[model samples]
Target: MFQGRLVQGYDFVDGDTDPSEVGAPYVNPAYGHGTHVSGIIALVAPEARIMPIRVLDENGEGDFWRIAEAIVWAANHGADVVNISFGYPQQTQLLRDLLDACSDGTTTTGKTFPEIGINRLFFSIAAGNSGDSTFIYPAADADDSNGSLAIGASTRFDRLAQFSTFHNRVKLVAPGENIVSAIPGDRYAFWSGTSMAAPIVSAVAALVKARYPNLNPVEIAERVEQTSVRISYGNPQIRINRVDALCAVTLIPPATCNP
Candidate 1:
């Protein structure tokens, strides 16, 4: 069993510090979104520890500044991979700056978090469900050149989901339609959205990290993208790729798989 704690940071939403309280009635009243995300990660890498920071409330909404603070806290508290499944339509300078700083291995204000060097933290964010080319904060900030990955939704048939937001910022797509995962009250449910897709990427990241602990965030992302299956969709033939867990963990170089 994985030994870890769920960190609670939502002042507007009530939660418990006790890890057992996770997914309990009042702790995750928003239909178990955070719990579901955490469950996906655990399934992917059972050996890795999960740190759930409650930045969003039951409604899947939270203050941007509070979200920024959670990022800082995660970095400071030994977070190797942070999975953010929520997004905003518009990018705010404050949120962008915070993410940029976090990517550079510092706090939102340029100060470095102790023990965590520059660019050590990696973030996997959702591209949102706008079904357009609109950009979403944090996800839009994903720089593959850095350690961040912006994920879109892919159907079981290897096609992009109708509701998934797409743009140049998105690095890859994953299975997000009718995904069965854990929910509150010890139940499981099938959910869809770019939010669901983001955690799948996060789980793969954890596997990559576990296999190659020396690799930085950028290297891990490169491994993921390089090992994915290329797929094309849309009228103009837009090209994207889907994550292949075997290729990522085997450390096979890019182009080794059939396209």
Candidate 2:
């Protein structure tokens, strides 16, 4: 069933291109966060292609400038969706500029539309693990007007995770606590964090994109948001919603399913 359905993927984290290297002690001793993320995307959108671009190191540290460049690379290489499982505590102008450019259908280096006819690319970013409403780069910058989705972590009980950062910028929440996914060495493990949550949104975006190829990033993001299950988790000041894939795929116009 998995044959001929393999999707091309990219990894921006550190270590060798070989996903198995994630199991090596010197490579990704942290246990393959990128690989795990890719696995989730594949599971959610089994027919979509994935491209791995290594940007962050084994310690999950990377330069903002490099990340900006990676976004351009993904766009130029025909990537329909980009999933960012990492976040910075503070915002940076450079990152903001790159993301804004992407939303406007341009590259950071001033390049215009690609040959693929795609204007804007979708991005799903993790809120942060700081457990506060403090702003995190990229995620905090994610605006619905710009076709980006900022994701926070929510528990299976429909409550926000204590470690998840909250803010008005957060667009959606997903099941992230103790979530099980693929690790290196053909293994599966339970992981938790906004990192885990962001990919869920990314995968959902992929599904929406695959089903509705005509929808732009903004429309796709809207479908994901509108079809979500609303949850009033503790913070009255913020509205948190969990993704509902079935509703997104089956619901029609002017009709929504919110549980």
Q: Which ten residues in a row have the lowest lDDT in candidate 2?
A: 14-23
Clashes of each: 1, 18
Question: Candidate 1, which segments miss by more than 4 Å at Cα?
Answer: 1-29, 106-119
Q: Report the C-alpha lDDT of model 1 over 1-259, residue by residue, as the tens digit.
A: 2335343433323444443333345555555787777887777777767876776655566778777667766777778888989888777777666555665554445644453444367778999999999988879988767578899999998899999999888979999999888876778888899889998899898899888889888788888888998876866567788988889999776678635
Model 1: how far residue 165 lies from native, Å? 0.7
Residue 213 C-alpha lDDT in model 2: 83
- Model 1: how far residue 21 lies from native, Å: 7.7
Cα RMSDs of all predictions?
Answer: 3.6, 3.4
lDDT of each: 0.77, 0.77
Tens digit per residue, CA lDDT, model 2, 1-259? 2236444434555434432333464565454887777777777778777777777766667888778767877777777788998888778877666665666665445644343234468889998998988888889989767788899999989989999988889879988899887876678878899889988888888888888888888788888888888876765776788888888776554245674
Clashing pairs in 1: 105-119
TM agreement with the true structure for every prediction: 0.86, 0.85
Candidate 1 local lDDT, residue 68? 68
